[model samples]
Target: MSTPLKTLFDLTGRTALVTGGSRGLGLTMAEALGEFGAKVILTARKQDELDAAVAHLAGLGIEAIAIAADMGKPDEPARVVEAIQAAGQSVDILVNNAGTSWGSKTEEMPLDGWNKLLAVNLTGPFLLAQAVGRAFMLPNCWGRIINIASVEGLLGHHPRMIGTIAYNASKGGLINFTRALAAEWGAQGICVNAIAPGYFPSKLTGYVLDKHGEELRGDTPRGQLGCDDDLKGATLLLASNAGAHITGQTVVVDGGASII
Candidate 1:
């Protein structure tokens, strides 16, 4: 007999680690996994934020915990992996969502800003994935890696409207990283994928939303910005057994914005 559809999406024994999961898109995805029966671990730079997120998840009756670690720091990935190991669990799902952005004109962009964005947005995810995969996934021979890329990664943004060249480049690199890593690890039962989200109301895009909310809405065929729940479904699909055969793919959750 074939497996039931609901059973395929169930993640009862899974553990998920979500970087930058204290707020915004990361938090949204974390909640989805937790709600569907995965134990979730949230990582970010702030202990207070992490505590609050854990409390929120607890209120929702989801098993959750927090680890305060800045993904940009080189030593932090090992620390995060250690924390999980200490808890007597390994990550079955990894979400690379911790990132930072800088807005500046290309010619006038500061070298420091460029480097900082790349470190946090691109390099951080790479290191963390390496640590987790080595310590857990590779050993167990089963894992799911969901990279949080952006629509900006898929297309160039207008310099005058949004000066985030480094951010765009970093996310673009992450998208390809997802594809490359999937190819390398698929034979070992590790599925790697990416989610490229469009505009959503978060601290990361507060300034842009304040200035161009209407303009962006007009640009999107949906005539609206994404809500908190917009990313939940796509994330669940990729994180569960439902996506067993899906790997090396980027599911764009932009309400048809990228289509145009």
Candidate 2:
């Protein structure tokens, strides 16, 4: 492809912050943004893991920095925002990829587990968005908020899938949150959207992958589960200049799994 065509997906002069970015899907998304020319800031609870992730990205010739923060904490968002500002970075692209999942029967699930899932999956994203938007994005009149949701948000879990009530509910809330925020913020130049992934091989889906790898691959019409690279194209479409007009929607990247 020509350089000009590639420019549509370029993120030059952009700064991105991704939560839960030390490993798994967050790091995957961070790699995509950084590789596309965005200066990326990655956050997770462990400083050492973040350091390793940053080093990996740096080795790839991408500018990446790692910060330590637990997004699940009520006050941590503010601290994270402040840390980014203190480093002289204002997030232009915010990927709310920090999330947690727990599974149990409705009656068997602990209240603590339910609350923890919501705290990370739903509240953390909103708080971080609020911090970044109010502190930076609004003044600049340009921003992108990409929520990493799941197909479970749209449809109930399969009987074979086991308990994930809290996860499902939180993701559903996140989708609605994206729409509501987009409706109010579209004219302000902030685009809120989501990507509802299906059967990605991440920490959240490791159990299923370990147990039903063959079954998952065979059941999906595409005959495959998602890989880290699978997220890059959809992510760039949302974060780069190409997707300016797109907002308030969830782009499902399930490789035909959901439809099948």
Candidate 3:
């Protein structure tokens, strides 16, 4: 019998690990997964933030577990996988949303800033995906890996926009990372994909938006910034079985910003 369309999207009995899920985009994605019945594990650098995120999910009747692990740190990504294993749960969906950004002129940007951005934005996702795939997904032969790239990955920074060479570089690399990983893992029933979002109101973009909100809106073909709910459907589509046949693709959710 064919599975119903509704059944294809059901995530019951699965587990999702969302890095930097304590707030903002990460939290929003986590909520979508949990709402569809996946047990969620939220990880970030701050315990308090994780706790609050868990509380917020609970308020929505979505039970979630929290882990305070910084994705930027060298050892934290593997440790997150280990901790979840110790809890007797395997990650079926891995959302690499924990990241940092630095804005500066190319010549003036310090090496440290560039390194930090790559470490979190590119390296962290690679490590988490590797760990989860090796520890669980590869062995189980089924999983979803969502790397949260950005429109910055797809286009050059506008002259009026802030300088963010390293941010753009890392995100651009991530889009290819998604393609490469998917090609390698697709035969194993692992679907690797990316979501390249445009500017949305979040802690990560608060300052950028404050400085160039109107300019950004003007550039977007939609003539508006992304809303809080903009990412929910994209996240769900890629995270659930509804996206079973989709792999090695980048879903640009920039409200037509990248088009113009």
- C-alpha RMSD between model 1 and the true structure: 0.8
lDDT of 1 by residue, 147-255 (tens): 9999999999965585899999999999999999999999999999999999999999999999999989998999999999999998999998899999999999888
Residue-level lDDT of model 2, residues 1-260, one tens digit each, is 53466888899999999998999888888889998899999989999999999999999888988889998998999998898889888899999998889878888999999999999999999999999999999999999999999998998887786689999999999999999999999998999999999888877788878987888788789898998899888888999878988999999988887886
Q: Say which prediction, candidate 1 or candidate 2, comes out ahead on lDDT.
A: 1
Q: Find the 10 residues in a row with the least total lDDT in model 2.
A: 1-10
TM-scores for every candidate against the unseen true structure: 0.98, 0.96, 0.98
Candidate 3 stretches with Cα past 4 Å from truth are none
Per the 3 Å backbone cut-off, how many clashing residue pairs does candidate 3 have? 0
State, as a TM-score between 0 and 1, how close model 1 is to the true structure. Answer: 0.98
lDDT of each: 0.93, 0.91, 0.93
